[model samples]
Target chain A: MPAIQVTNLHKNFQTKRKAVGLRGSLRSLVRAEYGTVEAVRGLSFAMDPGELLGFIGPNGAGKSTTIKILTGILFPSSGQATVLGFVPWKQRRQLAYQIGTVFGQRPQLWYHLPAIDTFSLFGKIFELDDRETSKRIAFLAEAFDIADLLETPVRKLSLGQRMRCEVAASLLHKPRLLLLDEPSIGLDVVAKQRIRDAIREMASLEGVGVLLTSHDAGDLEALCKRVIIINHGQIVYQDKVSALKRTFLTSKLVEVRYARQVAPDFHIAGTETLKVAKERYGVKLRFEARQTPVEAVMARLSEVGSVVDITISDPPLEEVIAAIYEQAERSEAAIAK
Target chain B: MNEYHPTRTPAWILLIMRELKFLLAVWKTNIASAMEYRAAFIAQMLGMILNNAVYFIFWVIFFDRFRDVRGWELSDMFLVFGVAASAFGLAAFLFGNAFYLSEIIARGRLDYYLSLPRPILLHTVASRSISSGLGDFTYGILSYLASGYCTWDGFGRFLCGVVLACMAFTSFMIIVHSLTFWLGNAAGFAGLALNAMVTFALYPVTLFEGFSKLILFTIVPAALMGALPAEFVRAFSWGALGKLFLGALLLLGLAVLVFHRGLRRYESGSAIQVEV
Candidate 1:
């Protein structure tokens, strides 16, 4: 059975529509108005055990809402979701024991206490035996290289150190599933690498299924094999991370630095003319399995001039996500038309 | 799968104990940190002691101006003040985080408790330990001793009164904290309501006539924490004691029910990214 299965999940929030200005506020108090905002709408997905899945979307796209339902934090207005054979909302306590969550914005550690104390408290909370607790703490502390910072107060630690401890605190229970919402946010490059490595190791070695959501595409590239894209409270796409890049993104930018100036009107079949400069020029060419391979782009650039240096790159993940959004808008418009 | 699953994990009991343990751990750390600023700790403790002593002095002066205005002696008033002050102080120390509920909930800090395998209310209440309660506990003991109401039977009654007062006050704090689920910005309102309740509680129920006393004793239950308990201590009346116990039970039940019902409305904020 899959570790998580969500079907037709929906959530709506009743928000007070307060008008601006003192007069408007007073009028509202006398006769208030409220409107229902649909936060999550008919979302559905499933994740196999031991799979690391990336959940991505713009702000208010219901990414967090779906995660909350899966983690047993919020009940869906309609539909059903089960994590590890337990209905997440109805069997929240059981689900909690089987899942660990790390929210980037909030550290679960008590600020005034040392990281070690929070770990110990979690140990007690999860009902871990003394030996198991010590073993897990030692392993995580060493893996995250936070053993030295364990005795220091959480407030005194750097953001990176605190995040490391936060991740460790969540994992002390050795849950089979780990839910991370932007765990790499606000971390420097080295810290992000460390966290990515730890996540990969957890999924591969311990067989822990991980469902991660991040605005950083690098996080998805580093740790996830499967990606699910959400937008406007709906799931637009779900597939292998590689397949997402292969399908939505069709072209790659080829930059060639020539020994001399290349003709400005340089053109090649199966490739669009992009830009040309004195020493370097770029071309956007469709990535085809046969004709327009990397070698073909390279050979064509060489034909233009002596290729002193060359590099090929796909468009940024953000651009791809934006294109997906634009495509969704176009499709909706077509449906309306 | 193993077939040896118990009805429940006995987790609720363990969760409560863990909360108590966390409270103690936090209390120790805060005290150590507080002691680092010894002058401030001593000054604050002294200031609080004097502040509480002034209330006792005010009541003594009131009695001096008019002896027994409402069929109550000066000692009876002191008993009421002492019980309410001690109970309020105890609640403040134990559930001080209740004051931060608005910020915690708004910032989605409550997500940690919700994700944990325990009752959110118990975890929230036990998240912190307040040391200022020691001062209130001392003041209560001193008031009970110095008021010359320390007969063997009176001593027993006062202890019982303290227990019931603690129960009622804790229930009151729970109700106030649970308001965050609905009000979202309940800290200031809770503080105002709590201050008014505490102030009104430190007076004789007889000082107010009919409806007002009934309101205090029932709806707010401030009078039960103070006047009724004090009345029982001064004179052993079965009826007053029964009323105090009954009020404590009702308040506790109502507080728990309100908290659970409100929890269903709790749309936990996302901690993935806070706006500010």
Candidate 2:
């Protein structure tokens, strides 16, 4: 059986409609209005065991809603979902033993308590044997490099340190399936890289099936083998992460710092000046990687002024997903017309 | 990777034991959190005790003038207030989350408990501890002594009354909070209902008559939290104790049923909340 199987899943929410100002508020108190909001409409997908799937979507695109359903946190309005052969909502307790979840916005650890306190509590919660719990804690502490942090109160640790411990706590049971929602959110570049590395290592070591949702494109590129792009509660794209990047990673964003200020009109062909700071002697440029060679673009940029430093990288994942959303919107509009 | 092993034990006793174990774990965490702010915790507890003492003073003054209101003397009033406060305090101290269920449900804070592998209502109710309730618990013992119930049997009976009162108060709060599933943002209404229940519990049942008395014994069950338990403690009667036990069980059943039914329609909140 697949690790996760969701078919024709739908979730509808009835939200109160509020009017503006005091009159409307008083009016609503006497006679309130409610509207149905379809959060996830017919979301269907299946994940094989040991698969690293990147679930990507813009905010309010039903990413978290789908995760909640899969984790048995919220019941679907209609249709069916099974995780590890157990129906999520109906057999939630049975399914919980095999799965681990880390929600970035929600801290599972007790704020005032040490991470070790929570680990011990979770040990009782999962009903692990004393020896087994101790062994797993020791192993995870080393694996996540949180040996020192285990003693620190969760409120006292830095975001990165706490996140590392959070991931470790979820893995104490050696779960077969792992679900992480925006695990690298608010982390610096170095912290994000460390987290990505730790997650990839853990997944490979335990052969755990991972379904990760992240807005950071680097997280997808570094870890996921397959990517699912969702918008408006529908799947717009699903394919190999490498393939998605290859098709859409057509542009490169380049930043150049000059020793002296360059002319306002000092521009290069096949390139767009995204930002120019005359005082700082810095210019940000964007160009199609396929259309303009990096060597040609560099040659032209050097002509403007003596280059102090230069950096080049692909455009962020949000831009790529935005383009995909735009393409999907256009197609949807065409179908509507 | 380990195969998925189901933890669904068929034995009802074992299930209750496991749930209890989880409850203890959550309570430990809550108490530990409260202790982290030692000065504030002490202050809250002391403040609550003083507040309850002030209310008892008014009862003492009233009894001094009128002697007794429909056979309820100063001693009975002390026991009534003691049982009500202690029962409420015990429930609040251990299952503090019960008092805030409506707010939690309205704010979609159930996400955390639902995601875990435990009984959702039990976990939610025991997630936090009310520090101020320590005062109520202390006052309960002191009031029982002050009411001149100094015998071993009286002490034993007071303990029973406190247990019944706690169960009744906790279950009643659960029923009121469960309304959020059907009526969104029912926090304001739940608070008012809770206040009414507390107010009725603090007074003598003799003060109420006819439909008001019926409502108290049935829907609101303020007597279950205060008068009936106090009456049973003061004068032992199997009939009154049986009624209180049966009533508590019914309220518990109603709470569990209402909460589970409401869980079906729970739409999680969109607002970003971080406890840390």
- For lDDT, the strongest prediction is 2
Clashing pairs in 2: none
Q: What is the DockQ of each candidate?
A: 0.38, 0.52
User: Fraction of reference contacts reproduced per prediction?
Assistant: 0.39, 0.63
Q: Tens-digit lDDT track for model 2 on B139-221?
A: 88888889986678988888898998899889999999999999886788889888988999988889999999999988888
For B19-53, candidate 1 gives per-residue lDDT tens digits of 67655654554455445456766766667778788
Q: Write the per-residue lDDT of candidate 1 for residues A208-243, one digit (tens) a residue.
A: 999998878888889999998888788888899999
When summed lDDT is taken over every stretch of 10 residues in candidate 1 chain A, the lowest stretch is: A279-288
